[model samples]
Target: MAQNHEIANEVLEAVGGRDNIASFAHCATRLRIMVNDKEKIDQNRVENIDKVKGAFFNSGQYQIIFGTGTVNQIYEEMEKMGLDGSSKEEVKSQAKQQGSGFQRAIRTFGDVFVPIIPVLVATGLFMGMRGLLTQPEILALFGMTKETISPNFLLYTQVLTDTAFAFLPALVAWSAFRVFGGSPVLGIILGLMLVNPALPNAYSVADGSAQALRFFDFIPVVGYQGSVIPAFVVGLLGAKLERFLRKRIPEALDLILTPFLTLLIMITLGLFAIGPIFHSLEEVVLNATTAVLNLPYGIAGIVIGGLHQIVVVTGVHHIFNLLEIQLLERTGANPFNAIITCAMAAQAAACLAVGLKTKDKKLKALALPSSFSAFLGITEPAIFGVNLRYMKPFVMGLIGGAAGGFLASLFHLAGTGMAITVLPGTLLYLNSQLPMYILCNGVAIAVGFVLTWVFGFSDKMLNEMKISGK
Candidate 1:
């Protein structure tokens, strides 16, 4: 660790001291740096530094890829040197050069989603466990009677489980604000407005009679209680708007007026414009998804299962959360939920395969825990630490994910609620689509396990490819 730290500091100095850095951030495995002049930085020198795995520039940011644990320490050192930005110029420039249409769309989605993954996984697992404990049958199986599951315990568990989803906008707001160099508090306040219980609700009339006027009109400012997209959009707008206001507002009144006016305008626009547009788009996507799933279960499962890892990696997996919640509210079961479950099973299979096949003792140890975690619906450890490091495991995971997805779709298995654990969550699909869900899940896990065993451990496999040539 000391050697790693010294290497990181040397690399930072090589790139150009604190003043040369425009902004700095890190993902799971890379230290992302924005420099005032990329040409002035010595990329080769930085890359050659000890413990520096690799370095590259993309999306207008200089990125130094390092071990996951090392990246954060490096970023902290950068912050201490005052490299963090106070302006939006770097982000704006990156956004503009990101290209147009689908390319830009995917990048934007990834930018918004990746930062909040840790929180999502933690909360998701808590919810999944809560579901297991709450089930009377499951409790009895554990030798704990219904009396053991107290109301207070259930209530607290529900709160812990649902906190992430319920305050999703706030999370989005905080993340976006950080990215944009704005006050997260302001963004959180704006996000809360869209979901606030004190705010007015929308109503409908069935018989062509006049509907009573609710507090706010039904102009598509739907509740953003558990939303992801709206807060992100609003945060982007707020950041740019706040910066603009700071320069324009007079120095005397800038402190109070800047935030006040910024919040008002951002919230208004979020509700009236951005919120409605995305809401409609979401509805369309949901409807299209339902239609696709309703057609043929096997095909749907295959596509969803295969794309599950990709979706999660890109961070758009939350779109499924919205679809699931919407379906549950309307129909009590969600078709998309099964896709995620299968995705987890596939990841686990891939991890297990890599664990069994690896010659390196350390790699195998890493893979073993990752496999167990992925089976429990936590894929980050497997994705970043194990599968991602081995080419074969990643491909196998994708193939396995697709296989599982297809099976789930074919069986038409749907989940009653979101889950963090795949094994226990399968029970949630038992009531309406029990047979199909079981069959699909079983087939997916079996295929994943078999394929991983067959391909992952083979001597000729890509996982055997080693950087060190050991």
Candidate 2:
């Protein structure tokens, strides 16, 4: 308790005292503060504070990393010292003000998609499990071939793995509406209308199992199962229209009229205009992405893997979320997930090497756990707190990432999922993919560890950072 209080006091003094803070908040692993003047805070002094692993200025706020549990304790102590606490949204609003217009648009897309990733991730795992269980070899051991498997059992598997993607647009739309400050229920219904059974399924139409309903022998209409872009566009436009209608309609009429007009206008535009136009554009983007990922001799893998962590440093990596989602929707697989996993694994290995090479006990303590956290797909601690603080290690990690990514592409490794990476990502490769995934990550770790140990770290480097060896 006393240690927390003392640390909080030191932080207060280091950040130019109470008068300098505009607002403050803590997330899962960092204390976020927006200051009246950026020049007032001592970055080095804040990093030097006990239990503070790292500090960086990002967006419009200064974020001090304190790992997971420790951050909450420090935040409680700071609150007791009379610093008013703000919600994360307030901090994000402050951050939103700092970036370029393009960056803000990317951030909004992130806001819409992040809430939907877990559902897709779970569906991917279920698909992987179904694949594993249905493998001929596995089924033979159970005295069953594909033909002998119970019809009900296969249907049950489909229920688990298929339902999420089947209704994915609804999830995307609901999230978009929430982020756009509109009624989520309305967004859900609007989305459901896109995939209603009355329309021909998009996949069926594409595969020639069913024909699309044509309007004026030109406009094609199909149920948007497994679609993303059209639903997102409709949700955004619908939310804006709903808000606009609410302001103009009388209060008594608003209750009845707002939703009626918003749905009618959006659905008509969605099916006839937005759906077809954006869906075609979506196809173009997906095709381009597929071509890049399929670039000869693993070039795409090397570039994306090597530079991905660099992008993370800029705090704009969430843009990949949309691309990954689109890949999953179109192809039923995500190659990007496998490639990024290599990048993450390399980062973990580089941080671990630094932890092992450093004689400073405090630095070692921070590095080891941070490395493990990276191994589990959370790399910010390892990246900002350990690897990037020493430039050579970060470069070594990037090289390692490139090497692993090359193997991932050469092996044609694609996962059944998105989001989950590194250790937890194994669930997405539970079939024939398991061996290649393991090999790729192993190469990344070895390359990262060897490079970092040989050239990236030394006690002198620590000395320059003023980190003392005990």
Candidate 3:
């Protein structure tokens, strides 16, 4: 354990003594830093500092990893030292000042969602696999007809899959409220209004009634269950409004009045303004996606196939998620889900290449399992621990990903829903176009593996460098 002041001083000094840092932010476990210049950062100094476990740089941000339960305290200390720890403001300003329109949009989306991705992926996989295991009827469709599919099993699977998604709006509201520096509870209340069944319906109709009573018509609000964007927008507004209301009210009456006015204004605006806009935006996004996916399947495949890893890294992969949820809600089958699986395969192939090329036992040991995990759609271990450490592996993975993407697209293969594991999930796409998606993914991985092995090694060069050092 580090003394509060000691950890604070160490972080300030490591980040170039407060003056060097432009802004700072902390997430669940890491401190996100921005400095005047990257060169001024002292990685070894920070890593050796008490309370900080390690440090690394990625996607233009410096990350200082800390032990469990320490990040919030460290962040509070940083704020006391006058560091601007508002990550949301920093991201919005940066996007406005820099990057193209598309890039800016992507950056904004990433800023809001990236911190929550691990939870989403883990929970998504957990629910997806449970559904596959327990739903014997689903299995029977795949020729596994030995066991009877029980209603209880089906109900349990629904509960498992539905739990995470059912609570997503509240989750988004909670996170976004925190980001905007407001009461998380208030945000949850607003989110619940959108999803909660207890809320009174605006209008009611009775069959064969002489007179119809319509309480509230032209109300554009829809159930926000499984929604991502609406709650985020409403929460952002609520946070700002809460802060403003808090400042105006007397300290004695502050709590009651603040929430009362905040909710009143926020709910009204959410229904009249934000909800409709985002609903339209969602439709726009869907229409645009439909148009793009309607392109020659090969061309669509080539584009998405190639860019999937890049999308994942930047954290815009959630946009692909919108398509999946929309399809599930409306059509019950999503075509783009296969793209993610192929992208994972590409990453795994690259990891395999690195494992084979490296003579270092440590590197090989790390790469082998990472590749296996990536094949199962868990690429963070492989991406951060393996491919990211070496330049060649990342490039190889991207190439392989593109190849697999193209092939999967070429066959117009789609998935029923998202899968936790890419390896077995690929089997889900088995239909008339199964062979095409499979062959494309296999060829892409194999080619990537072989190319990485041939080009990734540097035995002679490494030996020469070692000799020179001696």
Candidate 4:
């Protein structure tokens, strides 16, 4: 522990004392604070704080970088001090008003999707495991083939692989409802209604194997299996409708009538109107995204990989979960995964370069662990504490990511799963493709290290850190 009380005291004062903060939260490597007044902050003083690698305002919060494990302690310290220790939900509601229109929209998208990533990630890993167990070489070693696989094993694998995509809309709707301030239970129920077994599955409809039911002989009703847009829209509409009903429904009847009317009205609207309309729109967006991914040679790789960290900086990278899920649902593999892993590698490598070159003990201490963490598939420590602090390092990371991404795309590389990346991503490429995965990561880290060593760090930065004791 880094003397929580002292660090908390320093953090509290740097953000202009406890009174200036509207709310506080921490992600992997930063203390994100919503301040009542930006004018109160002492940016220079905060950046110079001992153990703080960097500081900046982004996504409507004055974020001070403390690197992974340290942030958790500082956040708890602030709470122990009786400051605005709001839950993530409360902070989200308050912070929504601070960003520009586009920023707010992106934030909302993140709010809705980030919470559900763990669920999908777990499912994705299971799917990858299923694929691995059934690989031709592995099966041959066991004296079995796909046809000879045990039905019991196959059945379990199907559950592991299919369950997530089958109920994806429900997950999205549940998360979206929470983000939009609706009752999460209601959102979940509504999501289930959209994908009920009684209705024709969306995939069956897409494959032209099932006929859609005609509601009132006009509207088409189908299950929203593997769907995102329909559930997301339904969540928004249901939330707004619930808020409206709660206001008009009398206090005595609040519990009963509000639930009754909200569910009845929203479920009906979702099945008849929202599902059909938005499902079409979802298809269009999916097509466009696939077209970009399928673009000639390495353009998509260079663009997506180069700019991916910028998205991380904006805190809107969670939106890519939706895209990656959609890709997995449609293509049965995520081509974006290996490319993203490469980007993460570049970030870690740049941090490692700084760790090697820095003379200041404080800077070296920060960079080494942050770099190691980044290489393990978590980049926030490296990104916020080391690379982004030196503008040139961040740009070098981008170039390295672009180079790695270009090669990944040129080779038509893809991952068997989403979520896991950098070091852990090796499991995804465990089949005969493991060497390729290593090579791609090697390309990324090498370029990032060489470029950053040459251009990102300097004697001057280390001198500043030594003098200021940063």
Question: Top TM-score: which candidate number?
Answer: 2
Residues 382-447, model 3: lDDT tens digits = 776556555667777777767777776666667645544377665454333456557877877886
Q: In candidate 2, what are the lDDT values of residues 258-351, reduced to their tens digit?
A: 9999999999998999999999988998899999999989998899889999998887888898789888878878999998899999999999
> Using lDDT as the measure, which candidate wins?
2
For each candidate, what is the lDDT? 0.66, 0.89, 0.66, 0.84
Error of 3 at 304 (Å): 1.8
Candidate order by decreasing TM-score: 2, 4, 3, 1
Q: Native-vs-model 4 lDDT?
A: 0.84
Stretches of candidate 1 off by over 4 Å are 1-107, 110-130, 133-175, 196-198, 202-232, 270-277, 293-295, 310-337, 358-396, 410-442, 455-457, 461-470
Q: In candidate 1, what are the lDDT values of residues 1-470, reduced to their tens digit? A: 24655776686788787667766667666676777776778765674565454566655567676655766777676566556643334554554464456555555555555567666555545644565565677777888876876788878977776676667777777778766778878878887877776543321221334342333556644466665567788998898898899999999999999999989999889878887777567568667867877867478777777877776655346445445544543444567778778877877877887778767565566677767767777676677555655556667777776777876776666765554446766556544355666666566667776777776555454333543432
Better of 1 and 4 by TM-score: 4
Query: What value of lDDT does candidate 1 attain over all alpha carbons?
Result: 0.66
**Candidate 2 regions with alpha-carbon error over 4 angstroms:** 467-470
